[model samples]
Target: MPCYLGIDVGTSAVKALLVDEEQRTMADATIPLETSRPQDLWSEQDPETWWAAVQTAVERLCIRAPAAFSGIEGIGLSGQMHGAVLLDERGQPLRPAILWNDGRSFQEAEELRRFHPELSRTMGVIPMPGFTAPKLLWLARHEPETFRAMRMVLSPKDFIRLKLTGVCITEMSDAAGTWWLDEAARDWSDEALAATGLDRLRMPELIEGSAPSGMVRPEIARAWGLRGDVTVSGGAGDAAAGAVGLGAIDDGSAFISLGTSGQLFVTTHRFSPAPETLVHSFCHALPGRWFQMAAMLNGASCLAWAAGLLKSEVPGLLRQTEAAYRGPSPLIFLPYLAGERTPHNNPYARGVFFGLSPETQPVDMIQAVLEGVAFSFADAKACLVQAGTQLSYAGLIGGGSRSAFWAQIFANVLNIPLSRYEGSETGPAFGAARLARLAATGEAPETVCSAPAVIETIEPQPRLVDRYGPRVDAFRRLYRALEPEFRNAPTGW
Candidate 1:
């Protein structure tokens, strides 16, 4: 049986998976990469590091099962979205790749709103500093030498695609996050480019997410022990791929991913942002489809922080504290450890622990983290509702879903059941593999989603529903009350 290789360049690591046409995993490998924090509130990584990690992962996957490489029919790349990777005239990285989590361009983003109010109005959303366009503007202003030498701009995944096929290309799903895409038209927005003072000519050729870009280069093919003729498909952003992996492609079906960051994704046929600009509107992995997404800057990271403070891991700690967390804790944690993105877009926001006293124990901290993340999800869900997407329930994925306790907490707080898949929690790499299959076979994305197994369903407890209803309302108000403070606060990473 022919297999497809899916490469997912994530924030912390590069993951590669070999999957057969029927979606059976043959082998997988992950290589860790380091991210740099040069200053508080800034995040960056060398693009060369990502390439190295990808190369290592591909080689490892082949070693795990050499036969898998022979059956490899195609390759696809998915990655963290919204990062800016500038390449010079000679195709060398101009500087460290500004990451999706970086917040150094807020002042620049503000200038965009001031100078391009009309463009913002038409786009239906204002640019955040963490977005690609603002980062590019920052580079243009601060690094004139590098800016002058720039020949092409691409996201992290696009850079990898270039390494694989020697072609400069990007897909709509990733492009939609760049603030240059006209979400409605599914193409680069001329008005946005003119308003932002960016050169549209420098952008990579836009293609459908499933379109085949080119074959893998012979040198990389030989190094990784793969066929030189393996077709490379245009993969999508991580969130879109995650949705595909979870089989959340139909309207009314939603996918909630809780990784380092958290996002609530609602599939939609039309392009629309929430009236408050709390959620992002982007093209979906499915060609010509769109989605509205709300992101939380810190989700599982909050729990991870608490675990680090206690010098423990979340899985083991949660297992010990699960039975003890019966009701809400007095301690409330604001999970803005790295500031916030959705609903506020405030880069100066900092995490806070309110109501902490001598009585607050490790279990209390763990409970606070879980509740805080759930509260944020409630806020995101409200944005979806405001946009007229009535999502009654959501499919859950990621490390957060492994815990039955956290899943129940989320269900109770959101007041909706959580649906889960049975097999391995395939992340974006699995989704990319499915996309490659669709490209090769001409099968509809929805058709491939058939017979996805549901492992469990978590329903909200009726008794906790009334209790959490007011708690969620209070969570929303707390953010509003702290909005001014967050805007004026000193930077804290």
Candidate 2:
């Protein structure tokens, strides 16, 4: 009867899920979150808003299933990766947390890479504007006073853990993306800290994803109508957590996450560093596990953008695009609305609707947008394959996975089977819940982390694959041709 609560502190929302020992969902709740962009290339959110959102989300869950909430025995945390939440001595946030998509730290990233030439090898990634270390470096350079006052730095989810358990702790998977953790050693690297002008003193306690970090505060337990013995598990980064949710933890196990940002996540047994190719190699939520991820800053968000531009609901857009799903559309969308991460790593990149003509219809535009996102994932898959990560099939999870058309397109573009599992739509929150079940029952992850029953398997249609092959090629060439223009263009452009 014991249930677990998994909370995912996402970029645009806070999601809470309750699952029993058998991994069956008992209840779930979500609270929408808003990010602030005070300047170009900047994305931030008040850490306190995350705290409040968690409380509100949990309160709603309790209302839906009071008995299940009362039986909650453990908590797991998953969140947007690489976010920088600076806390003072009293554990209060010094400023708004910089998100994973924030690009203001590009200069700092370059400077850090220059100072630590071996950084890519050490962190298993090319230092980009979004990672946590660069954000810290940016703070040191531009906000020295605040940086000096910083007592701790935590990711978005760990910030919530601080509020829940009155402890400051982070796990390996999330830490791996910080560009400070040694992925091979599964610990914070002193050399990385030195390069960023940060010391181990400011870092939180490091634990593995499955390890118990702390116990819930008595007050929080009572307020949320939960048992006093609820333990907290070291959750994971959003992608790793989503992989965990899908039970994609073994070698060769991979998944495509189409959330606010997209990631082609492939699990690896060894510490695989693909820095030269811009592939992200990092630890998985579980111990002795590693994953390589190629992230795209824009994912399902592109569909949202299109919806806003066309003044249509997402469901309606999907409905309209059904007829154009496999049809030819001369238009191609770049899906660089928030810039790009994988392959290009160009923060200045802008979205483009190339090949548009007077005959183009709204449905053609929608089809192009979806195809563009799919092509971007195809690019990430190519990098992973080049890095020697062999993947025959992958699970699909996230808000975009609800679209069968999108799933089919991904399968065709990637030329592999894409499985959609029952309850996979919950994504990271459910993965966190599974981790919570592990912590609560001391169950072997193999027993508890198994993939849920697949509801459908999207196999690549040969004709569609052939159709997309040339278009995917064109997608790559288009980006290469536009790179120089993006670099030279003014900020206003």
Candidate 3:
């Protein structure tokens, strides 16, 4: 039986999974990654570290299931989107890759939007600081030397692909987030590229997520003990991969992703642009499909930060908070630890606890953090609705989806049923494996990309929804009140 390997170069870690033809995950491994914040509102990482982590992850998986690993016939790649990986003529990184959560390019993004307001409808998103084009523009101004030396730009996963196959390519889902892809055309937009001082030559070849981009280099194949050069599929960005994993390919199929960053994504059959509401209209991993997404800058990262500050493990802290939960916590947290996206699009906004007092307990803090993240999703839902996308129900995927308590809070906060599936935390990796299968066997996507077995459908309890209703109002009011403050924040922060 043939096996396929899927790797996700995530913001927090590199995860690899080996799956057989029967859709059984044979082995899995993960290697943690770190981000460097050299200055305020900036997040970056050395592109080489991603490639190193990928190698280690695959090595661990190979050790765990050598039989299955040796039978691997295809490889797929997925990763966080909107990262700017500038490369020299030798395909060497010029500077640290600016991440999706980084906000140092806010001015550049604003400038781009100001000059080319009309492009948003075709580009599918208002050029935000988090997008790649703005980051490149920032570099061109602040680090002109590095920008001049840059010969190519690749997304994070495609950087790893460069190492794997000595080839450069990116799929539509990931490219769509770059603010340079023409979503309606499903191709590069020269007009948009010109705004960033780039052209088609700087971009990698664009392909659909399930299409074959290249083969694993023979040296890599030999090291991995593969039978031959494995076919490498052009996998998706994390969001689209998660959607594919959940089989959210049809019109109006919706899901929420709670990874390092968060997203409320809805699949659509047509390319419907909705930039007025700050909702992202981007291409889906599959061809001839698009999605509207409200992307949040912070998500499970808030929980991680809280856990670290409290010097506690996440699981234990969550258990404590759930046990102590009655209604809402005594505090309302703004989950803008790394600023916010979606409805606000405010990069200067920082985390705040509005109701902390002498009576505040540790568990109360944790609960507030969880509630704050849920409330942020509520903001995302509101944006999607404003963009004319309705969410009667949605699937939940990513590292945060493993928390039953968190999922329940989301269900109540959003007032919609959420489907949870087994191994949902690795949805992108599994989805990549599905794409690998399609590439290796020439299988029809519909047959290979079926939804996995769902463990439960979390429904909104009326009592909980009613309890959260007033608090949601307060949350919105708090953000509105603080918007001016965030804008005028002291220079140090």
Best by lDDT: 3
Assess candidate 1 and give its TM-score to the true structure: 0.96
Computed on alpha carbons, the lDDT of every model, listed in order, comes to 0.81, 0.90, 0.92
Ordering by lDDT: 3, 2, 1
TM-score of 2: 0.98
C-alpha lDDT of residue 304 in model 3: 96
lDDT of 3 by residue, 1-493 (tens): 7999999999999999999989899999999999999898999999999989998998899899999998999999999999999999999999899999999999999999999999999999799999999999999899999999998999999998899899999999999999999999999999999999999998999999999999988898888788766999999999999888888888998989999999999999999898989999999998889999999999999999999999999999999999888987769999998988788888899999898788888899999899999999998898888888888999999999999999999999999999998889998999888888887888877898888789899999999999998998999899999989987887556
Pairs of residues clashing in candidate 1: none
lDDT of 3 at 209: 93
Please write out the lDDT profile of model 1 over residues 340-387, one tens digit for every residue: 888778878888777788878888888888998898888888877787
- Model 2 spans > 4 angstroms off: none
True-vs-predicted CA distance for residue 188, candidate 2, Å? 0.8
